[model samples]
Target: MSTKEMFLTKLKRVIRTGFFNFWRNGTVSLASVLVMMVTLSVIGLISFSGAILDTSLVELKNKIDINVTFVPGAAEADILNIKQRLESLPEVFLVTYATREETLAAFKERHANDPSILAALDELGENPLGAVLNIKARDPSQYASVAEFLESGNTLSSGGITIIDRINYFQNKTAIDKLSALINAADRLGFALTVFLAVISMIIAFNTIRLTIYIAKDEISVMRLVGASTAYIQGPFVVVGVIYGVVAGVLTLLLFLPITYWLSKVTENFLIGFNIFSYYLHNFLEIAFTIILSGVLIGALSSILAIRKYLKV
Candidate 1:
């Protein structure tokens, strides 16, 4: 036979051997697969949870911002200059200027139905509101720093007089700081837990594959005795691992749909507008591909490691 024909013949034999071993070692294969599925499921659940928490936090942050109120009689030019200064800060996302007249109008609209509030405002006979700067930060952690900048130096003054009378971020400061800390702690804990679980799963998979290799030791020895190469001996086990990976990947993808749907409904019942199901469906292809790739790498690497001890050929 020609060299090309011999290579093709060997390839066909190796593939057949791989399928045969996978079926013959069905119990061991199933155990490894179950372990892999649990691992994949945990990973998917953690990822989904993290995404939901991140979205919720972003929504909360949008509702929390600094309110900078200028003292009565502050010039518009000075306020506008201060707004411009605030806009230059790296942490600032936006700075909106609301004149005293606008503030008065908004207050009146809010209290339009309350005769007592209307009479109180009418008795004042002048606009009692001050020019306010609504400042939004790019990150919650930067709110404190922005507030400090507003209170310090000439940034708040165009003519050397302190234009800013009050910086009202303290009310939400506690919550923002606490939330930032919580997010950091949760991230670290989640990452550590995921790593620990992944390591355990890898160890379990490796031991399972090692046991299968031990069972096939005699067959491997016979192949060696018959002058088979190491690659020929190892190819079947690698194929088995790949099969396990592909199966686990498909199972994980199927499992996430109903799981996320239920989670979405639960979240909406408690706190509307957080839809994990939509996120999962929108990113389904990417999530599925990632799980598949991770499984394949983990399985292939574990099998290679486990088989090395038994495959003397």
Candidate 2:
């Protein structure tokens, strides 16, 4: 036979042997597959959850901004002009202007049960609340600049604006900084745990596969004695590994999709602007490659180790 034909023939024979072995040792193969599926499923879930959390944290950080509360009796025109100027800043992503009346209405709706506060507000006659400008910055760290700009007392017309008394920026700074740090720490911890577990799983799977092949050492020797080539002998185990990988990949995907979907629904508002399903679907190729490559490596390594230790005899 030509070299190509010979290789093809060997490949066919290897596949045939692999399927036969799988059928003959159905219980063991099934057990290995189950273990792999569970292991890979966990890995996939951790990776997906970490990515989701990271994205959410980033969005939250971006939402963090300085709140500029106007002085009561500040001119409506001046407030609008200030808002326009703030919007002109390259660092500003968005500006929301809330009138004093709107602020009071919101507060009343939120605390409708507080009769005393409502009565006190009524006693004051005119609304004592200030128009508040909610300013979101392009960068969280640029909040200081925005605050300074508002409190600079440089651009206001005479008596057109009273300087901002309190920005509420400092109030939120500590909490936002702590949250960002926590998110980063969680991401690192998750990654470390995943890697540690994956290495452990690989070792266990590799040794188990090697032991399984070792149990058939005499058969391998007999085949070699009967003129079997290395390709013919090793091909079946590689096929078995490929089968294991494919099954593990499918099972992991099946288990993860439903759980992720339910989680997305449970935190729909919290995960706003994020699509869990789309994320998984987009990274499916990478996941597939990892699973397949892991299986192949485990299978080949186990086969080589088994042949070295047992087939040599």
Q: Highest TM-score among the candidates is held by which one? A: 2
Compared with the true structure, what per-residue lDDT tens digits does model 1 show for residues 1-313?
A: 9999998998888778877877887898888787778777766766776776677667767788899888888999888988888899999999999999998889899989999989988999988889999999998779889988876795646568787778889877887778877977786787788778877876776777677778878887898899878888888888888888888878888988888888888877654577888889998888888788877877778778877876665
TM-score per candidate: 0.77, 0.83
Model 1: how far is 115 from its true place, Å?
13
In model 2, what lDDT does residue 62 have?
Answer: 75
Over 4 Å off, model 1: 2-4, 72-94, 97-131, 137-149, 152-160, 170-175, 268-273
Estimate the lDDT of model 1. Answer: 0.81
TM match of model 2 to true structure: 0.83
User: How high is the lDDT of residue 263 in model 2?
Assistant: 71
lDDT scores in order: 0.81, 0.77
Q: Cα deviation of 104 in candidate 1 (Å)?
A: 6.7
Candidate 2 segments exceeding 4 Å error: 139-144, 151-162, 226-229, 257-293, 311-313
